[model samples]
Target: MTTAVPEDALVLAGGGHSHALVLRRWAMHPERRPRRPVILVNRHSTALYSGMVPGLIAGIYQRRDAAIDLRRLAARAGVALVIAEITGVDSTGKRLELSQRPPLRFGLLSLDVGAETRPSGGMPIKPLEPALAFLEAEDLEKPAGDAAPFCVVGSGLAAVEVVLALRHRWPERSLRLQAFPKRLEARVLQVLKRHRIELQPADAPLPGPSLHCTGSRAPSWLQATGLPLDQNGRLLTDHHLQVEGETLIFASGDCAVIRSDPRPASGVWAVRSARPLAANLEARCRGGSTRPWRPQRQALQLLGIPGSAPQALALKGHWRLGPFRWLWWWKQRIDRRFMAGFQQLQTMDSIDPDASMACRGCAAKLAASPLTAALAESGLRSAAQQPEDAAELLPAGTAGSSWLQSVDGFPALLSDPWRNARLTALHACSDLWASGAMVTSAQAVITVPALSSPLQSELLRQTLAGLQSALEPQGAALIGGHTLEARHPTPAPASLGMQVTLCVNGQVRRKHTGTGWSKRGLRHGDRLLLSRPLGTGVLFAAAMQGAADAEDLDRAERMMGSSQHPLLEELLREETEQEELHACTDITGFGLLGHLGEMLDDDCRLQLDAVKIPSLNGALELLEAGHCSSLAPANRSAWRWLDAPAGKAGPRIHLNLEGLPIGGSRHRALLELLVDPQTCGPLLIGCSETLAMRLESLHSWHRIGCVL
Candidate 1:
């Protein structure tokens, strides 16, 4: 079935441990980076190292110490990262329907999405999403009226950690660990014993053939999707990890129904499959048969507790130590060393441009270096682009309002492939918000470097997904877009940046435009209402250096993912009451106040109530402590101070002040709101009292204001 057309090969789906490790091994032996790989992952990074999860939960380890950093992994491996969830697969079409993309072609496919979670009925706790649940129930909103009892069911590692974590995290809440067994363990027969944790062993199962998963097991989504499954709802797979009957499609991880032998649903077996799975996929890409993957009999284990002293467990035996301060210290060393691999350190590089280093896909992708070079080679002048349709504009006859329009796009500034698309699209849509116009449609220009057909296709799919998500809510539709392959990785569309005229059909458009506005005309005491938070420039630049935390990065990502264009429309409707005059610009590489300075009239005095402006978490602190973004130096050159007793401060201006410091820990609560950037962005509706009330009522975004 392999095609000579170079378009045929295996597509490993998901960043499950097995698949993730397989990618690592494949990269290490890149004579075998799977040629037609279309790695499908729901998350950008698949939080590897589940063993340390309990230690992480117990506050024993930070998220970075526990995560694998799949972004770095994929980059090193030179693989496509299609961040999407697969809902269904059509064998007849050889296509997979992602939650976000059109049907994608797959020659030979394998899934390692992992089994979903099942929760105890009526129980407020969820075992799989333990971290989030714990944060919600115990951390954010504690028991107000009654003590909520902690009840967990299961005996395995996932269960054991939850029990101990609950005890450690919430000592005030009632602790109730209950266990009921139909039959005793075969070894402990005829012996009555008391243990801290209740042991449940049954000779006869709980009225069913399958083990009722109260722990981390198959969620309803798996059953709803209805992939080939056994009676127990486990996806049936062959010895080769290929799904039964559909050998062209494979399954791995705990979700797969590998009935050839009974195996514990442990991450160990998954990790062990790395070598075999990668080899088989590589072999398949080379037009050969897939190799067999065999699970190992045993793996070493570690038990974590949130106590002063630590207890250890493994296949070797149980060993309790007096104090694990030393043990935790040792563990920390090991974890740090393990996490070092995730740094942006590439293992391989080809010297010559036309030199082929065993490419598997249909096209040769341009390395990031060449991509940047091509973007820099653009001959366009430093002028803003204008739309040139022959339609003559009639002045708004002094009676009606008007709408404005402009367009922009750029090469991705992020290293994470999946997030790059999302952020770029978000950056592009910012123009719509800044112009105060509803985005009706978008025309795109995609430039993918020479790469495999599969890689190119996946990139295009991901790009379109990001655009669709950012635009649709504002009634914006991406109806038309053009894609071309080039010598660069930039997705810079031709529709951006040029000597262009902006046309609009609004009263203000015929009246006032983004003209005659300089630092002199802006009056003193004019209030500044930044539409979005700052720190995007700083945080993302920090991420490139691998200094940002996972939670902070995740928060930034989740915030940017939502459509900001709609928030602008909401602000416009909310601003109908007052006319302080709308004067604003969306925050971009120029940073918050840098862009704000551009909209101000010449010789005008302005006041930045360092306290009133909202900021994002960890932004000012990062900024003040010599952690400015890469764009900071460029932004500094744009400033020309006329009159400010604040001494014309630099990027850390948020912290520089005579009265209350804008970047103090006390001010962090407020600054965390103001510094976070909004993609597509919010409207800084500078109306009278209506703006504040509307923002309060909508509650979609945090509001902060200051009068200069």
Candidate 2:
């Protein structure tokens, strides 16, 4: 964690091969680290090693073997990893527009996004990400010839390699190559013929899975940036890889064209360019001169052929090596060597023997008992004494309605900053909603995790963008907030991640009377309505343990990040209905039971059905399997109201809804489930039974029990 804001930032636009190599070098040598924070923006959490892509398609390498985990890589480099798609660039403003978050400001920007192949019909494999997706969907065991015929388009090394791999994977399938250039070497043609692949005419129709290995083209978004470009639309750069006439902008990989030393857009040049790119970036950050990048005239290339005893075809300058078994051995060695660098970062101290995965959202909060006690000890009762969702405030102006104010913040729960920001905003605004207030304005307080200055800026930008997107729809204006680096004297656990807090101000629709729309107004016979499901705690805990299913996590995240403003707006729409809404609160860190306990009085209690309460998918299953969040024990402390131990056969509670002991131990499992903390949790509303009946018809509202 850093204590102060960074003055400068270096942003990498894409996770191409060159950028990956540059990150690897930076991770290895902290002494050469740039003063500006280094941030890598990629579409996914990992970058696939293009070198072993053919081997991956041939089933010779595992998917993990071809992937470089960008999250792990960024952590190793002490930088920030932002997973977002770059839509375009504002060259004049030095900002990169993302597909989902706010535009990111960059002091220095590098584009190594690689290139994409635009296909007339077939699927293009040049962009790598989409190509990897296509490869993953391949069904090689479809009874070979029973499947449709496969075809390859374009006459490049990538096309040949892909065709050979496809043929090897499904030998019975009829494979055809529509080589436009028709300039493959004799040895390459021999390898193709040996696989029984037919060379089709240029006009041949593409049948089944057609792999397009045509020439690479720069992304269309780059052309609109007004950057100097070659005829092919690639950003033109000088010998030092800096964009021509733009010292702050740099380009590499297939997306860049070198004016001083023109070369084909191939993985070889991208790999070789990493060294000088890293050096020049660091030099520029330090206000020093840069060394020019010199590319090799001819680089060695290894091509893989399909078969059990596959032979490698090596080519360079005017020389071509044989289809020999020894060549395959050498090719395997070289590919493995290339991949080894990414896999060799583990040090003994980096390994932890007793590290517990801390969960995000409400699970990251301190225990309520201790927090409450500390506040009481400090005599800070203003917030505690009037603990509704939002505090009543004087109207900002005479034209404004009564004002309500609240503040909320939490450590990051998701690796994606956008998701975290959106959730945080929703979580913060839920307080205002519970108080029957319409969000008017909000200010953000962000604490970025320890990363390079550039990466921190990117993280803050994405977080605020997400928050803005989530709030704007509710008619809330984001004014401004504070940004700070988390300052830790010693290294903290990875779970103590970035945090974001939003101080929200909203307008109360109803008059600011003490009797209505307060947390203490539960009626004698009101029904308690829950707006959403529970179980974020257990689900997230399972996620940390790698025990949660992807579908289950997705369901939990969607439920947790959903907003409840609309539902509250419906309940508090009319004046008569507003009075019927006796009390309201959003279940968050306190868990359902802990928060519900706060709403109880000496004269009334809540009667809940164990099965009536909604829970996130797979939450109960994980809880039954003994998975619990780090904060579970603290939340469970409130379960003592039941007067029974957790696992003792028939635990029962005598808590009365207007004086009556409900059923016994059948609710035991649900008792534990009730205390599971929530993130963007549902609203717990106390309303008339008539209104509850009306609300029960809606999917968003659940009538869990009655308040008496």
Candidate 3:
């Protein structure tokens, strides 16, 4: 069964190993997961596994091999993933100050952000991303004659592994380890000498591009939280992993210092603590007793050496093993096993499989024929023919020029309400922009699912905030609208998500002149250009089925988030002459081909190069797997027009599309892409070739075909 409006929020900060494990554990036991809404806030969508950092540096593994897609994991675990940086905490208010957004309120907070290394005034590799970039940019395989001397500062295991990886990449370089008077085991010292690495003094300057993997400290912001801290400035926690004095706060991994069982900062402890941390969080949320986490006193350490031959050393307590090939193999097995958990993720359907994924925005609209017939039957079309996206209602009045208005809305497609609001507002405003109207005002009509008063209020605030943010920048004020609670007498077996609509009003710049752009302005022999790619519907549908890649979903979200207002402005700036700009319309629920059919007049037939259309990154792959949008069939029904006889037609018009080069898998794939419904899709423009070139230099667009 689904949950009602949650009374509390459990916020997990950071995408460290411990938190990644916690999410994985919750995915395994969904029933045991907390009822409170879970939120995971992080700086990026993916987390780097520290165990594979050395492998990455040594060129043994690629970036993807060591990274986990936290966004996908959160979706699987039923958690909301917020990409933001946590700057500090408000202990009294139970809020977290974020870098890019408003402070987030939470009922319980957990920090597993890991630790930061002390700045050495040189290059530090504690955070991992910057260090990885540096390694990738450097020519590590250069000849010893062209290479400078290399040095590492610190006596920790990270420093040892990094230095060895560097040496393995360039054996001839003058490699050195700088340990500040700290003595190492005899075996480790011998191993360093065997690799011809010189030990340098701590006070000495770094020789070249150095990696400082020194001892780590807690984030400086933690000190300001007023929580008890260790001498090393880490948050102090009790046996139960709760902050010493703060009952609602929890900490783990390198950032937390267990007072009773003091342990060093290590990824091993973080991996081992995932279960207890997850269990304690579940128990705390349930108002039950929590168990204590007991860390191992001595953990096994493995170190890799440089060379074509696979060699590694294992150390535990005072015992040391030989630098054997089998040890390296064993470590590889462990690392791959850990990574496989993320790489081979399977999407388990919690919702009914038969329940179709809902299309949002224009795609959610009823099919054109049925809607048109209804309007015709009611004599609405006979009054003035079907109105365009925006209608010029008035001539020049004392107040302003011709007035244009259009209304658009659809059920929510995204879990993020703020983004949904923004997209919906943008979709509505596209009609005004197409008419070359200056946006004046906007009003919203929102329908929210049944929920508690406070939760419903929060949803409305978030939705309107996004709408206002998108509209105000275009100089349009949100006058106001209406809201309703959509509660059915008998609830459906499935969840009823929220929906929104925006009605926008605008004024044409010129008075009593037909200089504005519209769908009917197409000229024969003009080139067709698209402002964005297609295939969002297919990608989203694949995502609902757990078949889409995480990276693909991320790319789709970015494409949807982009506003077409800027593109509209750029096109207007380039088209000095009104004749140079032909027909223009935003691709909404209908696929590109479907929208293109609307722009065609009797004299013009579209001749498209199937290969020229652009699409989302992994769109075609999903299509090959038989993934398609819910509205695809309706859109593809346009094939009737394309197949119709040229001279025989009644009131219904035909969309003549011919000369498509479809000989291979790619051509067939593009055909399928042409009919995929788009949300905030693209602006299909028919313009002169000269204008297309000018717009091409300013934007990323495609010239798919032309009007014949």
Using TM-score, give the best candidate's number.
3
TM-score for each model: 0.74, 0.73, 0.87
User: Which ten contiguous residues of candidate 1 have the minimum total lDDT?
Assistant: 492-501
lDDT of 2 by residue, 1-708 (tens): 011222456789998889888888877876676765567888776778877889888778877788776656665565666677899989888888888567777788899987788656778886676776776676733766586777888787788988888877776788889885457877778888888988877787777788888777888888888999888889999888989988688899989978978888878999999999998888777777888877988888888785888888888877888878888888888888888887775322232424445666768888887887777789976545446677767643445446789999887776567778899999999888888888999998888767666566666766777898889889888998888877852122222356898999988776444332677778878888888888888887765554555456667766766677777677665436344677888898879988887776645566776667888888878876778888888889878655645765332323333322343332444666788888898889888877777766764588787764
TM-score of 1: 0.74
Candidate 1 structure lDDT: 0.50
What TM-score does candidate 2 reach?
A: 0.73
In what order do the candidates fall by lDDT, top score first?
Answer: 3, 2, 1
Candidate 3 ranges beyond 4 A from true positions: 1-6, 139-153, 166-201, 356-387, 393-401, 488-496, 509-515, 639-663
Model-by-model lDDT, in order?
A: 0.50, 0.76, 0.76
Distance from true location, Cα of 574 in model 2, Å: 15
Worst 10 residues of 3 by lDDT: 488-497
- Give the winner by TM-score: 2 or 3: 3
lDDT string, candidate 1, 1-708, tens digits: 232224533456667777777766654655667544444454445455666666665666666667776654654465555556667667766766667555556777777766654544434233334444444455454562255444555544455555666555655554434334432233221111212433445232322111122445533455765467765456777667767776467677776757785465667777676666666666666777676666765555544455656543333224334223555556555556655645434433322223212221101112223334555577422121211111123343433324334444444443333455555656655555555545566666766656567656655665666566655665666677566766543211111111111121211221233221112223334445555555655555445444555466566666666666656556555544234344545565444554454554443444455555555566566665445443354445433432344654433222323376544654543333233333334445343444555565676444444334
- Residue 701 local lDDT, model 3: 83
Residue 531 error, candidate 2, Å: 8.3
